[model samples]
Target: MNSEKQKLSVLIITLNEEQHIKSLLDDIDFADEIIVVDSCSTDKTVSIVESFKNVKLIRHRFVDYTSQRNFALDQAKNSWILFIDADERLTPELKSEIVTAINSENVASAYFIYRIFMFKNSRLKFSGWQTDKIFRLFDKSKCRYNEERTVHEKLIVNGPIASLKHKIIHFSYSSYEDYKSKMYHYGILKANEKLAKGIKPSFLLQLLHPLYTLLYQFIIRFGFLDGRKGVIICYLNAYSVYIRYKELRTITSSKI
Candidate 1:
């Protein structure tokens, strides 16, 4: 279809995402164009992408998630852009809904899609991971990823958003080792963001944060319903809090 008649573009930012890129790309083949903004990955990621036809690839250094997303947004030629993570894939239902939504004139500027987080090739229904909504598909001009932080990049937009029904599968972590590595890296970024904002937690507060996280995720969120997997996720979530605080303390100590 022509740009004016029926045009939808897929934007994915990647860095060493060789394992997950092919699966994600396979699901969104219905899009008119696919733009991959890579951060100089030193893996087979770029080579695999080169095998795909009509996929536009751009390379740039990694600064943060927001700027990388903005780069991809600028490269998207089509008016409609669906931003997705390299580890994420659009389901059949979501593709159908997106195509339908694009054809409609009265559809909202952006929409939130449910995310299904998976671990060890199994979908985690509980553990506060399922039924999570994230604003991903939006008009390129109306929205942008906030450049304020790193780990949790917020989609800062001026208008209201709509919701979609289908789920986007997220194979975020393959193993516990990978999860721990991510915790350390993301915790560092989060601590830096907090410090930049002049926010600091007291000693007791920081210590209690992890415990509260465990309680909320395991009990309040009913994570235990998911069985052993739920317990593991809750523990990991709590550990993330501890790692963030430790990183924060390290930053302060280094400055002193």
Candidate 2:
């Protein structure tokens, strides 16, 4: 098939994302089709998406990230797909690269995209965030999200892969409180998932495990070079780790 004729389908899953939906929709409008698999949001998110051109909105019951994402994948009509989160933006460089790649005669089955995380309107260059990469753009026939993972779910690609130099922007958190709330929520989800696997968070593991992540991110990964921002990230990471095990311990103790 000719590269220019190969259309790209962009997909996203949303709940109540009024604050970030419209901007994101506008950013990804360059794609041939915009597929939004919303989780029945009781807000202006759906209406905002409907206002966009070349967009198709489908509502589904929320379960887990992987399940919702996999469901979104099935909704795409094109062979090429690009997945973007509500808090992410498809930058101009990435947009051009994506179109160019799909137009290539010999394109990889999947592409790994790095993220430029935003916090307080600042781009995080370190704090272990520089390592944030995901297989987001790919041929739908050769890729699918693994539904088993509750958090940190990954896409399973069945063919050759490549990387893009440009990065998509991610608005990681709006405020410190928001970050903590996310930590609390994701931590519990992770804990429950671990419990389901028959893995227990021991007394020491609960305490020490989190510190290891802090050290690794701040020291080993040079998160400290990011300055005060790095400190906050490292601390939040440790807090999230602790919260996950704390939730795990609570859940397990109740069962006992």
Candidate 3:
């Protein structure tokens, strides 16, 4: 271990995430600063965060994911920012690797960290999650999330990008109902994003696209290998697609 610690700012965006906030804060205590941009959480999230004297919590209104993330970026005092989610966890090995990476002589502007997705305490190995990676650790001076994306935000890095060796453990959903609600929320956001781009919905696509998604995830992506849980995940994923177009149609129809 290095005797000197790096000047790093850990950023997190939260909304009613009382269940996982404490553990996440404890894990990243090695950082010099921790900034949490909360979206007016009604739960004990704000109170729990206040317990940590080192954490700086800012209450911001909920908009899109991109805007929330970009707003978090602006509040960071350090140049190096590790933007992690409330549902994600970092291992001891990964913590060491992160320190080494930033302290290296030839460090990249941004680094991609892979994750192991979990559904209801079960590790999901398939359903298009095998290659799940996100740009969590990066230089704030050279990177910012794309504003156009409302759901799955994309990070635009001005310099070189690299990948980390260790992976994060992502507890994606607490229950089936929770997962379904999250998917539906993502679907609605996606629909609004498409509408903003002047893209209209089609009835045929709403019907066929979901079926294709089911088949592609379960059969092509080997989701069947995971057994019963895989089937549920695949179905819900397809359902989210259906809900997206359904909501889009509902929004478009109200104009008349």
Candidates' C-alpha lDDT: 0.82, 0.87, 0.92
Tell me each candidate's TM-score: 0.93, 0.94, 0.96
Candidate 3 Cα deviation (angstroms), residue 140: 1.1
Worst 10 residues of 3 by lDDT: 1-10
Off by over 4 Å in 2: 1-4
* Candidate 3 lDDT by residue in tens digits, 1-256: 2346568999999999999999999899889899999999999999999999999999999899999999999998988899899999999999999988988877899999999999878799998788899999998999989988998999999998999999999998688898899999999998999889888989999999999999999999999998998898999999899998999999999976
lDDT of 1 by residue, 79-140 (tens): 78898888887778889999887676677778888898988788888777765888888877
* lDDT over C-alpha atoms for residue 33 of model 3: 90
Pairs in steric clash, model 1: none
Give residue 12's lDDT in candidate 3 (0 to 100). 96
Ranking by lDDT: 3, 2, 1
Off by over 4 Å in 3: 1-5
Arrange candidates by TM-score, highest first: which order? 3, 2, 1
Reference-based TM-score, model 3:
0.96
